[model samples]
Target: MALIGRILFVALFLGSGFAHITQAEAMGGYAASKGVPQAKLATFASGVLIVIGALMVLLGIWLDLGALLLVIFLLPTAFLMHAFWKETDPQAKQLEMIQFQKDLALAGGALLIFALYSGYGDNLGITITGPLF
Candidate 1:
């Protein structure tokens, strides 16, 4: 079920990454509202990162690098985009907290995947080029 697991894991990212690019103007506006600097460019760049990372993981090539890219995107996004602590409204705070927690969890999953591929060697999937490490 390794392939199935990988597919499930990347599902969220593929859709989100596509949206970030295809709807950059709208997503950028949302990012701007959240105080992201250079929102449009950042949104586009983030989309690229997400898509590339997702593809790498899905294809079982350079898995470690793919996981790292995901971690890189997720951590800061959790802090910046979903700053629950900054939300004064109870409902808004709750929503942000959920999003923040989700991001953290996803980041953790990515790290776990990285550790598995990097430590155990690329025996987990198709492994086109193998882990970069």
Candidate 2:
């Protein structure tokens, strides 16, 4: 169940990260439209962060670090990209709100993982910082 959960959690980001590479120009344009500075560089950097973080989490390699990266990725992204309050149109606001909620939920999940890996509430004292078995 843990493995499955981890896999599902990383799936969207894994695809999205790769998509930035395959659809670089388009993604850069979208980022530019979003007022991101150095849109192309930001796009590629985001892709790298997303991929590395997702891979680390899914593979159980330095799970704490992975979770931290995820939090960093989702925080600004949620408030910036899914700025629901900034949308005046009802439908657009609703859509952005949903996206924002999802991002928050995902960030929560990452935080949970971070806490677990950080030895926040574990009696076992087992911390695996390498590849999953």
lDDT of each: 0.92, 0.81
Worst 10 residues of 1 by lDDT: 120-129
Kindly list the per-residue Cα lDDT of model 1 for residues 30-52, writing each as its tens digit: 99999999999999999999999
**Residue clash pairs of candidate 1:** none
RMSD for each of the candidates: 0.8, 3.6
lDDT of 2: 0.81
Top candidate, metric TM-score: 1
TM-scores for candidates 1 onward, in order: 0.97, 0.87
Give the Å error, residue 62, model 1: 0.4
lDDT of 2 by residue, 28-96 (tens): 998788788888888888888999999888877777788789889898989878899999999999999
State, as a TM-score between 0 and 1, how close model 2 is to the true structure.
0.87
